[model samples]
Target: MPNLELLRIVDSIARDKNISRDQIYTDIEQAVASALRKHFNTEDTTEFTVAIDRQTGDISATRNGQAVPLTLLGRIAAQTAKQVLIQLLRQDERGSIYEEFKDRVGTIVTGTVARFDGPIMFVTVGRAECIMPRSEQIPGEEHQVGQRIQALVREVRDTPGGVRIILSRSHPDMVRRLFEREVPEVGEHTIELKALAREPGHRTKIAVSSIDSKVDAVGACVGVRGSRIKNIVDELGGEKIDIVRWNESSQIFISNALKPAEVAEVSLCFELGRATVVVAEDQLSLAIGKRGQNVRLAAKLTGWDIDILTPAEFKAGVDRLDQTLKSVPGVTQEMCDKIVALGLINVFDIEEVGAEPLVEEVGMDADLARRVVERCTEEAKVVAAEQEAKKAAQALAAAEAASAPPQRDARDEAVLAALGLTPGRDPLEKLAQAAGDDAGAEPAGNDETAKLPDPRQAVPGGAPETTVHKEQPVSSADTELSPEEQAVSLPDSGRKAGAAVEHTEETNADTAALAEGRAEPPASPGR
Candidate 1:
C-alpha cells in the first residue's frame, strides 16, 4: 500500500513541474505494483491489485478480495514505499525538464542564476538547469544568485547528473538569435544575414542581403526609428552593430565592409587573391580604423587580402619596395629579374619562404633572411593597400563625374547670345562698359568692325550720305505726322491715275483765274 504522505509529495512535484496529475499517479502506481509483484515472486498478478483513492490519498492492496498480510515490518515497508515514491517524483520532475528544453537548441532563453558549481555556473531556465562555463561567461561580468540573464542554448544532453543544458551568452549565435527575435524581416524570408564577423563586446559586422530587390535589408534590420536594433543593443549591453550589405561582387562587398570611410578605388589581382582599396587622404584613417580593425574586418568579411592606400603613398611604396628587394645581397640582377618572372616581383615574395629554407635556398644568413622576410611582408602590405586605394579612388571619381550635372546645350547658348552675352568673357566687364556708354549716338559698346543697323528703322531717303540721298529739311511743327500718316490720305495703291485727274482740273482753273486777274489786277492795286 502507498503511504498518504507519498501521495502529497507526488502532487506537489506535479504542480512544480506543471506535469499532469494523472501522469504522476500512473507512474507511482506502476512503480508500487511492480515492487509488490516482485515481492511475491509471481510473474502473473491477476489475484493482486493496487488502488489509490483520488479524494483521500488512501492506497489499498488486495488479494482475492482480502487485505494483504501486514506484519510489523510490513508497516515499515509501506513507509519505505512512500520514500521510494518521493524519489521517483523528483526523477519525473527532471524528466519533464528534459522534454521542455530539448527542442530549444540554438534559441535564446532567459534564466536566473541558481548557484555556482565550482568554475561553472548553474542557471535555472524555465524548468531545467543550465551549465555555463567560465570561458563562455563574459569577461568582468558579474552575476548574483537571483539576477536574471539571457543566453543561447548551446547543447542539450542527458547524463548521470541529470539534464545538462549548456548555455552561453558570448557565443556568436547569441547575437544572431537576439537579432532574429527583434527583426521581423530577418525572422521572415524578406531579409537574410549572410555572414557575421564579431569581436564580441567591441563590435560586430553582419553581412545582410535581401531576396527581393525592393526590400532594403539593412533598413529593415535597423527598424523604424532604430527601435528594433536598439532593443537588441540594450540586451547586449551596448555592443556596436555595423550592418553591411552583402554583394556577390567582392570588390563592392569589401568596399561596403569598411563603413563610415569612403573607398576611392578598388583594384583586384584575382590570381594573387588580393584586392587593393584606395581611399582619400581624409578617409584613410577611417578605412584602416584604429589599429587596422576596419580593414581586418573587411578582410575576413570578403575573404581577400585587403590593402588600403592613398594614391601618392601607393606608388612610392611599390617603387621603394621593388627597389629594396632588388638591392638585397643574395638577390642578383639575374635572380631578381627571375623572381618577378615567377610572380614574385614584389618585396613580399620572401614571406612565402621560411627562414631556414630561405637561407638554404637563397644562400643567405639567418638574421638577414628573417629581416628580408619581415621587411618584404610589411612592405608588401603597404604597397598592395596603396595600389588598391588608388584604383578605388579613380573608379569613384569616374562614377561621380558621370553622375554630375550635364553641361549647357546649344539652345541655352543661343538664348545667351540673343541677350548680348559673350562666351569666355566676364559679364561684369560688359556691365561696366555699358554703364559708361552713350545711348543716342549709337551703342558705343560695339567695336568699330561691328555691322550696321537694319534699314527699316531709317526714314525714307534719310540714310547715311554713302547709301542714299538726304531729304529736304522740314520744320518740326509741319513734319509732326509720320510717313504712314501722310500716306493715309493717298489711294490704297498710290496709283498715278487719281493724282493726274486732280492735277488737270486745278491747272485749268488756275489758267482762267490768271487771265481774268490780268485786267482786274490794275484796278485791284489802286483799291
Candidate 2:
C-alpha cells in the first residue's frame, strides 16, 4: 500500500510541474537518503545509499552494507525528508520555467496585470510570471489590476530566485512583433519588415518590402480601409504609425521614409552618410514634425543622418557652395559644379571630405585639391559662426517676446470705449482733460505742443534737457533695428510711452508732407 501511495504522489507531482517521472523518482531516492543520514547521525554520504524501484515505486535503503528498515527512520527523519523533497521540487519547477521561456525571447506574450510593487508590474503569462520594469512600459499608459497586457519578451534570465522573464512594451521590436501578429503576410515571410523606429506612445515608422512582387507589402499590411493598421494603432493606444515602402537605393529610401511630406529633391553624400532632403516651404513643418520627430525617426529607419531644408534654404546652400568654390584660386565654375554634383552641398561638406576625395573623385591636381580644401575649411568656420549668431539672436528675440506684456487689441479697445474712454488717446491727455473739466476750463486742442509739456524744456538747475526726437523718415536700410538697439529701446511693454507720443506726431508730419507732395510716406516697416 505504501509503495502504491509513493508512486501516486510521484505521478501527481510530475504531471503538475511538467517534470519527467524518472526525475521525480531520482528526487525521492535522494530524499530517502537524507532521512537515513539523519536517523543514523552519519555525516559520511558514502555510508548510506537509497534507491526507488522503477516498476513498483518501492524505496529501499542500506547503511554500511546493512539493510535499514524504512519504518525505523522515525518521525523527525520523515519531516526532514519532506522539507528536502519540497525544495527539490521547487528547483525542478524553476528549471522547467527557465527552459520554456528562454526560447520565447523576442516573441510577444499576452498576460494579466497580476500585481504591482511600486513602479514595477508583475504579469502572469501562462504558467510563469514576468516582470515589466518602469522603463519598459509605454509612456502615459497605465494598467489596472487583472488588466490584459501584451508585451514582448525582451529577456529571460536564470536567476537564483527563479526564471526572471523581462517584458517590454516600449521596445521597437514590440511593434515588429505586433505587426507579425496582426499581418499574416509578415508571419508567412511574404512581407519582410526591414526596419522600425518608435517613440513609444508618440509615433512609429516601419519600413517593409515584399519578397513576391505580387504581394504588395505595404497594401497587404494596411488591409482594407485601414482595418489592419487600425487594430495595431488601437492596441498601441492610438500611436500614429507610418508604413513606408523599402527601397535598395538610399535616396529613394530616404524620400519614402519622410512620407506625407513630399520631397522636392534628395541629395546623398556617400562620404558622410548624410542625406540632404529639400521640400517645398509649405511641407517644411510636416517634414520636420512637432519638435522634429518626423525627420528624427526617418533618420533612424533609413540609417542616414537626414537634414531637412525648404527649397529656398536648399538653393541658398548650393549657391553659397558655388560662390565659395569659385573664389578659390584654381577652382573654376566647371570644377565647382562638378564638386556640387558630387553632393558637396556647402563648404562644410568639402571641409569634411578633405583633399583626398577632391583629388580622387573630382580629378583635381593634388596641390589644387589641398588649396580648395583649405579655403573650404576656413569658409566653413565663418559660416558656422554666422549660423550660431543667427540662432542666438532668434533665441533672444523669442525670450523677449515671451517676457513682454500683452498689447491692447481691438477687443480691449472696444472694452475701453464701452467704459467711456477713447481707445488710442493718451492716458496723460485724459488726466489733463479731467482737470480742465473740474476747473471749468476748455478741453485741450489738437495742437501737439499744447497737449503736453515739452520734454526739451530745461529744469531749474540748468540740467541737460531730455529731448524726445520725432520719428525720422525711415529709409529701406534703416527699417529694422539691430538686436542691441531693440533691446535698449523696447520696454517691457514692447512699446515705450515716449515712442508712442513721438510716433503720433510723426504720423501727422508724414500726412502733411504727403499732402504737399514733399515726400512719399516712409514705407511702413516691413511686417
Give me the candidate number with maximum TM-score. Answer: 2
> Which parts of model 2 have CA positions greater than 4 angstroms off?
395-527
| Cα-based TM-score, every candidate | 0.55, 0.77
- Worst 10 contiguous positions by lDDT, candidate 1: 465-474
- The lDDT values for all models are 0.74, 0.88
Off by over 4 Å in 1: 1-12, 18-23, 30-75, 116-119, 267-274, 280-282, 309-313, 316-527
TM-score, candidate 2, is 0.77
Residue-level lDDT tens digits of model 2 in 1-527: 34788788878888888899999888888888888888888878888888888778777888878888898979999998999888998899999888988999999989999999999999999879999999999999999999998999999999888889999999999999889989999988899999999999999999999999988999999999999999999999999999999999999999999998999899888888888999998999999999999999999999999998888888888898888888878788888878877888989899888998888888899999998888889999999999999999999999999998668888888877776777777645777887788899666534443333465664667656344444434343657777887675535334556777897899799899999999976777784
lDDT of 1 by residue, 342-389 (tens): 334346545664456456545667887777677788877876898899
Q: Specify the poorest-scoring 10-residue window by lDDT in model 2.
A: 444-453
